[model samples]
Target: MDGFDAHQRQMETLCGRLELIADLLPDQADPTLCKFTSDGIVKTLSDAQAFEEKELFPALQALSLLETDMKEIFAQLREEHYEDLCFAEEVRDNLRAIIEGHPSQSANATGYMLRGFFEKLRRHMAYERYLVSALRTKKAPGTPDAS
Candidate 1:
């Protein structure tokens, strides 16, 4: 599969994993699970941000199918990515605090944060599905031979 497709699959797996995390948080909060989530999400968000900004965004930008109207959507997506990364770090720190025995300030708050993050992430994936569909239906102005 292409890089975009691969990243989409990764995001799907992450949503599943995050659902599992959501089910366990504030109740089970196992140190291993906390550490697993804390470590995994940061890396996953970082990689996705890099790929979207570098490869995916540029590819779309270079295509004729994307219009000025869509520019704002793309710009919003970039900002969302930054926000998502920052939010992931906050969640990671919270989870790590639990792993360190400090505990979150509130169980309800932890649940709220997890739900908020996943909801935002799911919205992003939905937008990307539309964008990717548009990309797939069009031909990029290039050949296998660069020249």
Candidate 2:
């Protein structure tokens, strides 16, 4: 698959995984499950971030697809990526805290953070879907009108 399709599929998987992790947060003290979930989160987000920065944004910019009206959307997407990275760090820290014998202290807080992150991520995915649709519908310059 192309980079965009791959990224979209990754995002969908991440969303489902995040929701699972969120639901398991309150009882996430089990070493095996905790390790599995946290590692998955870190790996998926890290890969997605790298792809977006190294491939997706540059490709779109080269195509001049992020011009005019799409500039703001593109900027917002970049900003959201930064926010996601921060959230991922917070999740890792919280998970570490739980694993290091602070489960009672971190469980609720972790749950809260995950819920907020998931909601924001869902919105971001919706925006990305809109952007993709916009890209597909956009015609090349000087092309004959479909209508």
- The candidate scoring highest on TM-score is 1
| Model 1 poorest 10 in a row by lDDT | 138-147
TM-score of each: 0.85, 0.71
**Compared with the true structure, what per-residue lDDT tens digits does model 2 show for residues 32-109?**
555665667666776776776666555455446654764676677778788887887777666666666665455667
Clashing pairs in 2: none
State residue 54's C-alpha deviation in candidate 2, in Å: 4.2
Weakest 10 consecutive residues, lDDT, candidate 2?
138-147
Task: For residues 37-99, write the lDDT of model 1, one tens digit per residue.
Answer: 788888887787788887666666666566576577678888888899899899888878878
Please list the residue runs of candidate 1 whose C-alpha ends up more than 4 Å from where it truly belongs after superposition.
143-147
- Clash list (residue pairs), candidate 1: none
Q: How close is candidate 1 to the true structure, as a TM-score?
A: 0.85
Residue 81: error of model 1 in Å? 1.4
lDDT per model vs. reference: 0.74, 0.65
Top lDDT: which candidate number?
Answer: 1
